[model samples]
Target: MKIYSYPSHVKQDIKEFIEKRLDSGTFGLLVQGDEDTIEDVKDLMFDQDDVTGNGSGSYTFNTLKAEECLVGNWDLLREAKEELQPNVDLIEKGPEFCDVMIRCYLLDWCFNKALAEIVNNTETVQKGDN
Candidate 1:
């Protein structure tokens, strides 16, 4: 997602703002701005937060009048992400945790499939006996 904070022409503030949010553990994905002039005001919202599980805040980059920063609360972002991918706790540390999650998901899928197959086989055997 791309965030357009007012003063898209003010590159420094936009970059600084995003970096601060990232360092604050507000997002997992990296943000990039400064698309135009170094002084151009703009902010880039990257992939949704992974570890933090947050969504992009709202904002308008270019407007006729001086625009107020439409910042989305971090809590709301967290809620939104949770709704989508709530199984994994976003606060877990590092890539190892992510790997564990993946493994868990795969195991769950396999277990479910095996259970279904067993049920089908059992039903078949019962019908044959009858």
Candidate 2:
């Protein structure tokens, strides 16, 4: 999916898709970025600890943080993809850091899908309040 720096009408499609799943009128989106990027994001939030909040705000933050982190290390993903080609399909789907960074990031996406659903549920709940 393409990342955006600003919230434009372009996101209307995803917003609508998310709206369809809002149970309580709230929608949430979860995205994964590189560990270094996540670390930087986590660092930026050093004092912000509340996980329960607006989905729109959180999604924007995640996308931005991931974009920064991924861009900073795009080469690592490419290298790993090249090096692991011999036996990539054999690796167990777990937290095992490999030569490539994006592999874990990609795996993080698999795990984050569930989180996105929960966030979507939250988003739906929030929408009902609007």
Candidate 3:
């Protein structure tokens, strides 16, 4: 598996967050946002609104907005997570932690999508040369 690295601060914050969750037995914590936020995430992942359909009504998905959303959300969550302290109430810090987890998952999706695109394009170009 490829090793993913974060900035020192983000890496430290994630380590502490995981330790706190384990210590508090909060492993079941759910990360969720409002419906509008959910829709925004979908749009960021798929560019849902920009999709087009062929004459036979089969839709083509072209854009991937994951990298853009991931970068922005990661920065925001990093700032919020950095403000957390060991003494801070878990209730107060839960939302920020959830945001960080959610963004991390999104970043994983973005990285996978980018990799798939690179592979697919390379295959297409190779086939064209035949």
Write one digit per residue (lDDT tens) for candidate 3, span 54-79.
12222222112222223445454454
What are the models' TM-scores?
Answer: 0.24, 0.22, 0.25
Order candidates by lDDT, high to low. Answer: 2, 3, 1
* Model 3: lDDT to the true structure: 0.36
lDDT of 2 by residue, 1-130 (tens): 3532121221332334334533332221123334554344333222221221122223224544534534445455455456545455524522122212342323333334434554566678879999
- All candidates' lDDT scores? 0.32, 0.36, 0.36
In model 1, the Cα lDDT at residue 18 comes to 42
What is the alpha-carbon RMSD of candidate 2 to the true structure?
15.2
Q: Over the stretch 28-120, how does candidate 1's per-residue lDDT look in tens digits?
A: 222122224212211122212221111322122132211222233234334434544576564553333332223222332332343344446
- RMSD to native for every prediction? 22.0, 15.2, 19.3
Clashes of each: 9, 17, 0
Q: Which segments of model 1 are wrong by more than 4 Å?
A: 1-99
